[model samples]
Target: MDGCTGKIEQEMRAGLRAFFTVPYLLDQGMACLEEKLREALLFGRLTVLHYRAFGGTGAGIYRAAAAVEFMILSLDIIDDLQDKDNQETVWGRLSPDIALNIALGMLTLSQHLLLTADFPHERSGSAARLMNEQVLAAINGQTVDLLNNIESEEEYMEMIRLKSAGLLAAACLTGTLLATGEPLSEVRTYAEELGIAAQMKNDIRDVLNWDNKNDFWNRKKTLPTLYLLQSISDEQRWIADYFAERLQLADVVNRKEEIERIMEESGTLLYSSVRMRTHYYNYLDLVGKISLAPEWKEQILAMAD
Candidate 1:
């Protein structure tokens, strides 16, 4: 991990330790929660990445980054509960009610941490509001995702901007806000681009797999899937039928290779890759424009690369 990500991770561990030591939490299951915190830390590297990229140079951002990590974990728990996938994960292994309780606890903990971060009062206050706004945007996006009501590529992009990019934008913006007391528009643009590009890569992986995490099995309407579905002939309409619940996975599971071929031949994969790279390039351009020293900027860009 980069220095920013590493320091923020350390702070998160310390915060988790402090929170878990509460008498009431200790009376509950401490071992399981400890394991869950370990898992949660893995997802928090982004917060620190943002903190460092946006000029943060002290331990001040640690509390806020920890809050961001907990907020993300809380949402991840909810997403797993809703999707019922990745059963081997900490949240998935536990009973749904227990998972839900943990999610709620993390959500509140995130808020508390954000309000108490060791930043100026004005900056911390604004950061809290921005965080809440972005989270609500993500919730709205998650709602659309769960409903699977996407109708067009444009609509899908919009939903992803809210669901995936919103939180990322908030993370990056929070770092800048804490460091400079002003959130730069270019930083927000770079954050959104990176978030969108990363999500697209995830979508490609999700479509190619053949498990509970498979987006196709889950009937997700990702850009690649929508393109592939529209490009195929009448016989391949069975793919749509499966998505519509007119067929089962067993009937189509054996056709995985064929699906891969179609995705490749139809240019779906290439199209997705092109789209991802476009945003990636844009992110790089913005990084180049940051008013940091050449070496510092190179380090940040290299980290992303």
Candidate 2:
């Protein structure tokens, strides 16, 4: 791990140790948290990177990154629980009630850490408010996603902006606010675009895979799947039927090869790739406008890769 990420992890462990005093809570929470820590701490890294890029100094920034990461882990647990996917995870293996309690505890812990971070009083308050607003927006977006009522590309874009992009914006803005005491609008814009691009990449992966989390199997209306549904020929009517629930998984489970071929020949994959690239390029353009040193700017741009 990067040195900054290591610091954030240490901070997160410290926070858990300080707050989760109950024996049962400590055991279960630590297990779930360790699972999350094993993955790339992307949000925490973003917070630390932005803090340095905007001239922040000292160890306080690591606490802020830990707070952001805690909130992210809470949401990840909730998402997996709601989706009933990724049952191999530690949280997934536990009873739902226990996992839910741990998630709620982490959520509160995140706010507590942020509210008490060693920053200026006024700056800490501002950052806390921004974090709450973004989290609420993400919750609303997640509600819409659970309903799965999206009918157009526009709705899908809006949902992702609120659900996925809001979290990234909050991470970047938290560091910027702590460093400069101002929520930089340019930073939020680029972070949101980057988040959308990242979601597109995940959607592409999910649509191609054959598993419990496969987007097509779940009838998820992602950009690629939406395009496939809209542009499929008469011979591919079964794809639309499966999405509409007129056909069951059993009817198409053995047709993965055919579906992959159709996704390629119908230009669905290319279309999705183009859309993801468009957002990424836009994010890069916005990144170029930020006033940072050449080396810092390069480092920020390299994150997209």
Give lDDT tens digits, candidate 1, residues 70-105: 788778889889978878876687788977877787
| Candidate of highest TM-score | 2
Model 2, 205-303: lDDT tens per residue? 999888899999999888988899999999889999999999999999999999999999999999999999999999999999889998888888887
What's each prediction's TM-score?
0.89, 0.97
- Candidate 1 off by > 4 Å: 1-6, 20-57
Q: By lDDT, who's the top model here?
A: 2
Estimate the overall C-alpha local distance difference test score of candidate 1: 0.77
The alpha-carbon lDDT assigned to residue 271 of candidate 2 equals: 93
User: Measured by TM-score, how close is model 1 to the native structure?
Assistant: 0.89
| Position 301, candidate 1: lDDT | 71
